[model samples]
Target: MFKDSVVIVTGGAQGIGKGIVHAYARQGAKVVIADLNEGLGQQLEQDLLAKGYSVLFVHTDVTKEEEIVHLMQRAVEQYGTIHILINNAGKFQHKSPYDVTFEEWSDLLHTNLTSTFFCAREAAKVMRHNAKGGAIVSLASTRAEMSEPDTEAYTATKGGIVALTHALARSLGPDQITVNCISPGWIETGDYAALRPIDHAQHLSGRVGVPEDIAQACLYLTNPQNNFVTGINITVDGGMTKKMIYEE
Candidate 1:
């Protein structure tokens, strides 16, 4: 569906992001993997290239704006211009609100929230010039609305992404750029074999989610025919946010 298009996935070297990279590459898009892990990033690049798909790994620390600038430049240089951008780069932090340092909180915001804005902005600059425009999807979390103990920092940034998605949608509407986000709940990036029955039963879908689940959602939101679905946060969880629980 993404034939000949240029797709950039931040944090594309591992886990959920890696799944997204594979999804786009398989659909015939020129995929750009942006992340700090040189070893994994290059490995993904080589793996995809071996399959005869166009892929490039750009070592990017999303927290750095200059590096973000370089990332977009490198992408365009490699494959004309960018068509889709996946803001999936982020880190997890779980600390009590009382103990979380200001530096730590600020750093998380820069990595998760600020980078989302700037990356979309930079990508939009190139995307606007195209007649067909482009699509951008940010990764939010179900924690944006619900909360667990000592998750203030991470939850705050996710809520910010949910709000930011619609705002950017309005701003970029004139340019024909569609902006949306996905809130994934309980996506197990580790050993699925280790999860017990209760884990699967916790979700309405009767199973825990995998990276490929979120990846398919990204593909749906970014598809050209789905431009009418912009400015929304699509929850990809197995109805976790809608379920109610009472402590025993």
Candidate 2:
């Protein structure tokens, strides 16, 4: 557990980000929910506070460097120090490589790749000074390894994140900061009732992944005692990545 630790989760208002936020809050960490959606962010903040968990929601567009800097400043001001950062603020949108505009491609790169670097840079600034050091976990995707047509933009950024994770881990090793990335596959953020048989059968684990599967991995990677596990990519995709595909 993360008792009394200060943790920041970008895009923490919904989906996998929300699950990670809840997991940390349940373990007594003072969590900063940095998100773009004011309504959902505030609601989640209030909900956690009602349960007597310490949390603060700061509306932040992570693609902008200034907003990210301000968000970190706010977190440190409130919590005194940052102990962990989960860079999960990203969108999955794809277009045909032939039809993707320059603006669209730029936006995708900024959102998924640039934001990851900025957040880690800012968090490491604070963590390096802390005596206990800190940990960072980023969200990549399984699409980075295997992708469908027209997924070039999304795939490129995810692949970038995996490389970024290892590079950052090496740079921050002297400072005792661990950096890691998680690549998730086929995680259905919606109702489990809607899944078809193929969805269940395709994965070697016999089911598609849920947010909690990734969230649990987050907890393990960022745990202070697990300092030995760093610079690695954990694929929480129910063995789908390892399975071979052929026409039946």
Candidate 3:
């Protein structure tokens, strides 16, 4: 469905980002992997290229404004215009509020929240000039509403992203550029599976989600037929956000 479309996926080197990139590629979309991990990003690019997929890897620090601008420029240079942007780059750390240093908190905010804003703003600029509305999807977390221990910074950034998604959607709606947020629950990704054992019953779906689950949601939101689905935060957490599982 995305044939001839150019899509940018931040942090596209691995995990959920990789799934999104592969999904777009499968749909015949030209994929640009914008990430800071140069080695992994380039490797993914080469691998995808070998598979006869159109892909580009741009080493980008999303928190850096100049780097974000360059990322957009490179996408335009490679594909003429960007039709979709997936703000999937983020940082995760486990730390208590008391133990979290200022630097650590700032870094999380920059990586998770600021980067989304920077990328969205730059992409919106291009989409506006192109005179064709584009879709932007930001990856949020169910933790934004529910919380675990020692995740103050991470939760805060995610909450900000949820709010940011609506604001951007409202601001860009007049231009037909839809913006939405996907709040994923405990998805079983390579990193998540390595960090903890999967418990299917923990969520309402009787299992944790896979990266493809969130990617599919993103594809739905970004689909050209989904014009009325802006400003909404779709929770792909297997109904975890709706259940309150608190032990007293």
Best by lDDT: 1
| Clashing residue pairs, backbone N/CA/C < 3 A, model 2 | none
Candidates ranked, most accurate by lDDT first? 1, 2, 3
Candidate 2: tens digits of C-alpha lDDT, residues 1-248: 79999999999999999999999999999999999999999999999999999999999999899999999999999999999999999987767899998888899999999999999999999999989789999999999899998989889999999999999999999999999999999888899889999989999999988889999999999998999999999999999999887989
Measured by TM-score, how close is model 2 to the native structure?
0.98
Which digits, one per residue and each the tens of the lDDT, describe model 3 over residues 1-248?
Answer: 89989999999998899999999999999999998999999999999999999999999998899999999999999999988999999989898788999999999999999999999999998887656689999999988888889999999999999999999999988877999999998777765545433467667787778999999999999998987899989999888778866688
Whole-model Cα lDDT per candidate? 0.96, 0.95, 0.92
- Name every residue pair that clashes in candidate 1: none
Minimal lDDT window, size 10, model 2: 89-98
Candidate 1: which stretches are off by over 4 Å? none
lDDT of 3 at 91: 88
- Give the Å error, residue 117, model 2: 0.2
- Which digits, one per residue and each the tens of the lDDT, describe model 1 over residues 1-248? 89999999999999999999999999999999999999999999999999999999999999999999999999999999999999999999988899999999999999999999999999999999999899999999999999999999999999999999999999999999999999999999999999999999989999999999999999999999999989999898999898878889
Prediction RMSDs, each to the true structure? 0.7, 0.8, 1.9
